[model samples]
Target chain A: MSDRLAMEDRRSSRLPFPAELGALVAMALAGLLGYLVFPDDLAFLTRLIGIVFLVLSLDLVTGYCGIATLGQSAIFGVAAYAVGNACLAGLVDPVALLGVGMVAGAVMGLASGVLVAKFQGLPQLVLSIAVGQLVAAMANKLSSVTGGSDGLAGISPGPVLGIFNFDLYGRTGYVFSLVVLVIVFVILLRFVRSPFGLLCRAIKDDSLRARMIGARVYPRLILMYGISGAVAGIGGALTAINTGVVGLDSVSFERSAETLVMLVIGGAGTLWGALIGSVVFQIFEHYVSAANPFHWMTILGLMLIVVVLFAPRGLVPLAVSVVDRIAPRLGGKS
Target chain B: MAWTVLGVVLDAISYGMVLFIISIGLSIMMGLMRVVNLAHGAFAMIGGYLASYALKSLGVSYPLAIILAVIGAILISIPFEFLLYRRIYRKSDELTQILLTIGITFVIIGVANYALGPTSKSIPLPAALSGPFDLGFRMIPAHRLFVIACGLCTALLLWLLIDRTEFGVRMRAAVDNGDMAEALGIRTQLIFTAAFALAIGLAAFGGVVGAELLPIEPFYALRYMVTFLVVVSVGGAGSIAGALSASMLLGLADTTGKYLAPEYGEFFFYLAVILAVFLFPNGLLGRKH
Candidate 1:
């Protein structure tokens, strides 16, 4: 029965060498391609950071951990403001700013975890909105502490280790973000495969069953939620640090919803999917907006509708499925 | 001073009544379908737009335009219910419902933008509602007073429809337990469809009545989504009285909040929403499941 099931899984399943190997190769290749195409790829470094943070955190929460939170953007906004406030107050170091953002995110996540972990179903959804509203309200209220609707301006960072400067083309930003992403990816790859990661997945798949079998449910959820917040915060802080422009967009419900979409588009529960989703969405936004700004929203809206309807499993899963079929034709299946 | 206080209370109550009309339909759908529809506000917006268009563009009278807009909203909702929302019924995954409805909301936003530009459009009161109606000691806008009466009437009518009628009994049964209702020959799918249509219809009705307050705009739906969400959260899912009570409280607080602090009104609304959620997750009236 096991062998038969394995065969069935292989025939239908897309797992080739391993999930980590594929992600690593893809990230490296994508990074290399970015470098090849743009000599100043680092200028767009924030996009890479954004992708990593959005994808990794989303996969951790929605994919691996099975927490489908639409309010991930809330923490992202909070961290962005944290970095913005820090930078405004003369905290110029990128690495240090990152820490501040993560701490802010940790605090916010811990607060929300109380409400999130307690409930299921409608309660969860309602709580997420309430949390988002609270964060946004705080941001708006403290426009004095954090720039109000106008956002913080003239936020030019001093560069990596005080060496590189932020160019107009986004090259430094791209390279810096790529390095961070690679490092984070390596750490995540190891973490997810570890016992903790397995337990996280087990908890997500069936919380009640996991609890029945002695899995510490609440603590695990709280831990992951905080970690995910930290990751999301890092991304937000990176953006604020790199771009030096912090605004309410970070906390807007639209941003949160879009990040979830990006996670869904690339692949749920898979890091590479989040990365791919973020990159695709960013690139799509860049090009689509270039054509006509109004068309951009309508196009994305239509794309979301199509994606939800046809590829419910998201594009990453669909891609792997195709790869699985094609590989066997090229002597992939043994 | 006494008369002024009475006036504030009366205005606040009437405004709350309008909010109740808008929120209760949303409560039913969210309770029964388990879909936190981001598009409920859009249906109300649609009613506002259609009603405004009828009054302004077609030169229809205000009351007649309202009726036309309600009809228009219902017709639009039928197609929306069938094509868009039908697939998501009973789906345990909340993400799908949210994303799908968001997508629908975006499409509606785009359509509204194309049909009725990004700028807000207001519906002029019909001649009858243009002036104020004087009571023994005080006076109120004829339009607002009419809305209050209509809102209360709708609430009562909805009460009968949901609690008293056979359809209501079946719906209540289905909402409470879908599989059991299905086994009992209730046709839960039909109930879902009817319930969805009714939900949209109520939102439309609220839209036309409250047009003066919440104008038709593209991002209007997005802004008010949290407001309705607050109402649902505080009221609990599946209870009309809970929704009514919550909506009235919110309306009164909102009016007073605006009066007390114009700039901080929205900020306080959100703060209050978070506090409410902290206090009641299933809402104030929600039964323990």
Candidate 2:
């Protein structure tokens, strides 16, 4: 076991710097390109950033921890509402609001994690869906505070360091969200490479074996869920800050389902896949709906089916495989 | 207060009947095949739309329209069973099943929206089944009575078919242990196909019958999916009696909650699900594996 651990550590360490550096470069480039190309749609792009965070967080539980959930939106919604409420109550600092969102997410995550960790398979799926719907129903029912279906509006997050104003153009929002995304992404990247993350992967691969090895499975799962919730909350906070409105839809079953779909499409276990899947799905949705407002859903549905059948591991892994075949030949010549 | 209570009870029974008819197919499929047919609601919606179209546009008799609708839905599902569901049955992954079914659901919703329009479609019930029937104490809608009767008949028929027949025996064996059933020369694949068709047919029948309670709309598939799923899960997936009882309980809870607290009705319903799942993870009547 010690030898295997050392070997695993050596393998992970061998390629860590280059892979991490590549991911960092790609993310930065994607942000820069989005800013350059779609200046008019910064708000939409910023919202996508938030969704990507949620999807990545979903990967932490689903991909790494092997917890099949459809209720990550529960924490996301709670965090959004928290941020909105905090803003309403004269807490205008964006950073502070983000902290509040993460804390709320962690609390909800811990609560839900207990329920989720108790069950397995179909029951777990059902429990997650129930939690998500319950949260959405609560948000809708609490009209006085949540603003009901109308949603909380006019959430003005006073600029980053009081310099870049959140203008009509959404430039400030985009940059602010980009910065947070990078920070969270780096932290997550480090976490997923650490010993704790290795234990999570082991648990996911075979919980029985992990348990037999004296690993406390339930607590680890709960902690993973809490961390996941915190990440989702950060995403929710970003959305609330950038969009200046938080609606019941954030907590809806539809959001949960869509986020899962995004995670799957990008690839489940890989962090980069979450980013790619969210971007591709959001972009495809935006363009398809713009082109054919009525039939976009059909097209998207077909795409999902095709993807599931052909590329079950998702587009990122598919791309990686193709690159793997080509990279070796190119390296041989060089 | 007594009359109101009676009213609520009657309403609950009728709603429960509708839910039972719609969700039984899903329950059986999940129990036997271990496939979470999330698109079950889509089949139901398709049945409702087809029946509504035939009644309104084609000027067909209600009974014939319903029969045709069920047949149509069955025909539609056969190809899906062969091409899509058959492929995934071997995977045995719940997430894959969910994704595939959700994809099917999205397609069905889109097609229904395109064909039937986004607006709700109402089935014009025949005059015979439309009016209120007077009892000594209260007047109840004849339609509600019809739903109740149909539901009871379905339950009795299904119970008989599943419990007292050779095919039922084979199906039960297959559900209990597919390899053993196959080894016993049960032809599990054929049974699966037939069962899939029957489940779709049942969904269509329920869709046509329960149109008044659940309006036929483009979004019908997505809208009622969670409710149907909740029913199947709460009822313990495989047991007919469990589905029946759970549907009734949920129906009563939903109706009473809506009456007592309109805004938090859905909230309470889901809360009950959470508690039920925590208490009985395999569902109230689900067999321990």
How much does each candidate deviate from the true structure in C-alpha RMSD?
Answer: 3.5, 2.0
Candidate 1 regions with alpha-carbon error over 4 angstroms? A1-25, A36-45, A332-334, B1-11
In terms of TM-score, the best-performing candidate is 2
lDDT of 1 at B266: 62
lDDT of 2 by residue, A264-325 (tens): 98999888889889989999898888987558768767777888889988999899889989
Fnat for each predicted structure, in order: 0.55, 0.62
Q: Please give the lDDT score at residue B178 for candidate 2.
A: 92
Which candidate comes out best when scored by lDDT? 2
Winning model by DockQ: 2
Q: TM-score for all predictions?
A: 0.92, 0.97
Place model 1 in a CAPRI quality band. medium
* Residue B102 lDDT, candidate 2, scale 0-100: 87
Q: How well is candidate 1 docked (DockQ)?
A: 0.61
